[model samples]
Target: MVGYALALALPNGKFDIAHAARTPGDPVRRRPRGNALRKPAGILVVREADMDELGWYPNVETPEAR
Candidate 1:
């Protein structure tokens, strides 16, 4: 699983990975070069009980008409 692989890649095997699924890197292919998912920008993670709440909503501004 992606989560398990990520855990092994971290420096101390401890992390608060929020958005670790957006990455498209193939771990099997990039593992040789120490490919690990890094924290993404503008992302948040909330943990509740037995399940985690994950969301990836992006905010893009629309240009006003000239």
Candidate 2:
């Protein structure tokens, strides 16, 4: 199964991923509609192995091979 790591930027200059959830396909479309009332989140598609934890990856150039 496919999964994602989702996190939102907080006003205190930190990220919040306490609400980690699973969604299919487009990450943007998967976000809750009420998210507009909160900080926008950052999403990255990940494999099942990577789903064990919640984390953030910023400005990553993700190619199958780096």
Candidate 3:
């Protein structure tokens, strides 16, 4: 394999969750914080299709957290 992986980071932290992957967070983990992963506490549903549009790609640096 080419050793490609989906990199990601915490919503607010100075840690890199993965390598080769570029994103502040993964679209797959766009669920509510309360439910963690078992449930979605909010109505906001982020699909994998929107990953690129939201800056979840390599070469694209993530903006500083506000």
Q: Estimate each model's TM-score.
A: 0.19, 0.22, 0.18
Candidate 1: tens digits of C-alpha lDDT, residues 1-66: 245444454552123343333334442443422322333332333222322353336744448422
State which candidate has the highest lDDT.
Answer: 2
Ranking by lDDT: 2, 1, 3
Question: What lDDT tens digits, residue by residue, belong to model 3 across residues 1-66?
Answer: 122222222343222222222323664443333123222232333434445565544655547642
Q: What is the C-alpha RMSD of each candidate to the true structure, in Å?
A: 12.4, 12.6, 13.3
> What is model 3's C-alpha RMSD?
13.3
- The collision pairs in model 2 are none
11 Cα displacement, candidate 2 (Å): 20
TM-score (C-alpha, index-matched) for candidate 1: 0.19
Q: What is the model-wide C-alpha lDDT for candidate 2?
A: 0.38
Instruction: Residues 1-66, candidate 2: write the lDDT tens digits.
Output: 122333433332233332324444444563453243234474333222335464457646659538
Per-candidate Cα lDDT values, in order, are: 0.36, 0.38, 0.33
lDDT of 2 at 33: 31
